[model samples]
Target: MAPTESQHFGVNMSSLEFARSVFGEEEDIGRSLTRGSIPGDMESVTLDSSTPWRLKDLELPPEPIMPLLIEAYFSRFHWYILLFHEPSFWNKTYKVYCQPTWRRRDLSDVVTVLIVAALGLQSVLQDSTWHGHNTFRIHHINHRQLLLDLVSEVRFHLIDLLANPRIEAVQVCTLLSCFYMFHSSPGLAWSTSGMAVRAAYALALHTKAPASQDRIAAQIRYRCWNHITVGDSFVTMIYGRPASVDAAFADLHELEHTDDLTIPPVLLDLTGFSECGDITSKVTFHQMKFRLYYIIRQALNRFRLLRPSQPNTNDDLVAISQEIKDVEASLAQWCQELPSLYNFEDWSLADRWAQLEYSLQNRPADIQEHAEVILLQAAMIQLLYDGAVILTHRPLLKYQVKPMRFSGSVIDSMQKSLDAVIGAALRISSFPVHKFEKHFVVSIVFHYLFMAGVILCIIPTSQPLTNTAQEAKAGVVRIIHASRAMAQHNRISRQTDKLLTELLKIAVQRETLAALDNTSVTGYHGDEAEPPLLDSEMSTTKDVPLEGPKELLQANTTTIYQPDLHREFSMDLPELLQSYHHTLDTGAARNELSDQSLLPSALLPLDPHSVFVSEQLDDIFGSLQSFYS
Candidate 1:
């Protein structure tokens, strides 16, 4: 029989067809472009031909504010080092503005500087303090509006900037991508990053420079290409989409090194001798970071290709499992090979906590730089490592087999993955919330926390809880608190805080109910003479009907409460836990619960009728949509 349209697509085709054919025709597709939606025919989209080149209308910050903004960019957004030769640009821009001919500078360079300045101001205002007598205040609202207006002025000339693509144009697109990410617009970031990648490829930035080119200029091109590649890989991972730059086409040349008592002349001239060594070190560090991300991108691509539309055969499942393990091994080796400067081995929790406290109360210039630069780098390395581990083991959660035949090793791997995620979260929690909030992407942090919550929910049913479980729960709570703190400044963090709260409650309830079941079973069996089997054995036995108190039914209902996304977490726990006992008297209800091994347990097979299983998968995939859309 042919499947109904609704059955196959989960929507009424007639309604879709009517909407697409009728109402869609009445709508102006050009207006959708203005609303930031892509059109079906890219060539048909209209551009405003009459928009003036109003570069003079662009406002420049007062002299003091200009330096502050530039400082903020360098202090906070260090990842963009490769995109621009900061010292040279800073000096050049300062000199230009100091003279009368600043307005005569290339419009593209002016727009690029404005983009960076606006982002820098946003970062500063997001993390600044205003002292009014006895009060300290953060003035983000007004500053954000100012930043938006600046961004709008640049957006007004976006087409003009891209019209004559050059190195500066690529920088503009890359900076714009970073700006979108700062505002939690991953979709825009992905799009803009792709544009930058394409622009870089057009300029052959991914190929080795011609011998005729200046060596310093060639080195700069190398850095820019890798920057684009790294940015593309990051967005691809977040969106679970294909990358813009083809790996085979990329130039994988390592930075040239020479043993000398003195630095290169080009480096000395670009950034004074005092800062040359630091610049070289940062470039090398970024190169290493890019390599790690490259590995992750390869793994993500393989996983996407291996994803099955239907249940896999035994051999396919084994292959997928081995593939994941191999990736994990590669990730382990990457971490092992990291340079000592990027390593986090020597930083103790106590030391980080101390630094964090100092950062929150006082932002001394030196300490603040240390926290933002060194500590942030270490945190990022750990975050990426943990994220890779999660991605590596996440597939096992969906790989289903008979419960009796399920391998304990998979469960063990998941446990370790969760532990690593929680450990990373704890490390991040030690950073100053305001600084961390500005520097880190909230969605990524939320992803890690959500993954941890899912693992926490399942572990109790799959195996006994341990001290590691308690530590993991505490880590979740700590990260939730950090998210809440950030929610004050960032809208995305507010959404993340709400989601984490819900997931934490669900995890707590699952653990609580599992404990209750174990207790009730022990008490019930103690009253009889038969020897009690292990809890793991009993939970896995399909033929054994283990008896428990009637209250277990009530607990099950409360544990798996229907999640209402719009509702707050205000339900009465004890009452909800006790209200469903009346249903236990019905034999059909009891049999249904028994046949399914309880209605909402995560340990059950992936049955369509299982509410918890379906909801869990939906929640995981739904969170993923935030990155792509």
Candidate 2:
């Protein structure tokens, strides 16, 4: 009479039997983030784009495929147990057991919420580790594509769910806030991330989930650490020491309410791992390793500070130099060994370490000569890219259209490559020039120059997304500045602007050609037909074809049909005459009429038919006048 132990655990034997009967011939479903070794009834879940519901060929919710997989796993293994135990838990908490519909929907909602949350969490972690791309010309190529793919996929779900609100919408919304932080494209990381975080906080407050609200707020506060890390590293690396760590940390308080007790822990490598679950241990552990390189960097910085002039030092200076050498040795060892620790296949973690090592090992010199060369490289690339856009009249063609689109995930792949390169650039840019390797500088500068092309092309389209015209202008100006900065050798030549202007002309020409091609206009083309010439003197049958001029000559011989011919051809004749006559009169006829200023009472209107005619029309008109006389 009593239910089995499996029944209490919500393991549905019937469902498992049904799944096995249906899809037993297929291979066993391996480790899925959702299924966890459970066998699946379907071979794969495909998002069919042709359907109105946004997906076809799949009999489940489209966005949360992973969640559906988990749902199936739960139904297969523990449905009977969940059917009994979960009801008891519900009855104890709410004084009534949840109905079957309510229970089913609740599981779906929780699973959806968790999957979405994981995506956001992943984005946040990935972003914090970014160092600004400088190693390759365009952010790390492969990584950028991956990131873009991920964002696009996440966004599709975000848009769909947000457009249709449900009780589970709050968590979906919360997770979306975390997604924006990872968009490292130009200005998006700041604006979109800030909005997402705020939206998450609002959703938490509206849902009356104080704990979720606190947690979300804390996550937002934790983001301040990214800014802090960047600030500390930037200040120390560029200017020799942090201007104010206290001032930087002050931003964290604003992200949270004064009364919230659950604060997100400081996300320095070690604490980050302890807070995260096993599913994300790979992410956590690598971040710890990623942070290790900075320790060596800081020591190297300190050594430079102590010996600014690289002076021949006493025993103390020698001792400090030895310590710096030891740190470098440790860094080199760690860089070589750290890659094997985590699942290197997960691009989210591997990318950060790869970028850090690239920066530390391969950066450029700070000498004026090399900087100039870097500048020239940047200039040349920018000119070429801009020229392409101006000539072709489409922006970001290479990155977005032909090259990246050749890949399956267009936006996602583009974003990943962009992210890696951007992170490297930012990191290398922040470091002191002297510390950078010559090849690294050349390589990074070359990459930025290439990226600068992509960026400049995208900026025109991206400008409208900014809050103000000033911001748009600022962004454009920044690109211009970057072009100038990167193209050092040509900075003084004025060739850059000349190149830009020529590209503008080419762009205009392209547009004109397109319009002509569409409309079939031949007037702009040199090959267009020329108008027939007027009749020659003494030509036969000349009088037979002069109908228009003969008709005009019959009306007026006194006026002679001289007809202001130029005036007849003029488009803005009235305005032109007004200006012309006004100029001729000058100030002589201001108050009194003079001979030159005297106006005719009635002037003859020019007839274009009479003004323009074949030479035969003149002889015909003369004969007509003689007959009239």
Index of the highest-TM-score prediction: 1
Candidate 1, after superposition: displacement of residue 226 in Å? 1.5
TM-score of 2: 0.21
User: How do the residues 1-629 of candidate 1 rate in per-residue lDDT, one tens digit apiece?
Assistant: 01111222223244333344456745743544332212332322122232323364655544555566666676656443455556666766455544444332256666777787776766656554522211212322356556787788777767766654567768878888877875747678888888888777656676667788866556667767877877777777656577787866654556543221122333333211232234334554666677777777777767777755344444554566677778878887887777554565534434643554454455445434543465456556666676676566555444443322224454455345445544554555443444455553434555554444444433433322344444445555665676777777776667656765655544444343444344445456555676666665443333324565344444432232111210112122223222223222332222322443332223223222321222233333221123123
Q: Which runs in model 1 stand beyond 4 Å of their true positions? A: 1-53, 79-81, 93-105, 130-142, 250-280, 307-310, 349-372, 400-465, 517-629
User: Residues 379-413, candidate 2, lDDT per residue (tens digit)?
Assistant: 32222222221211111112111101122232233
Residue 457, candidate 1: alpha-carbon lDDT = 34
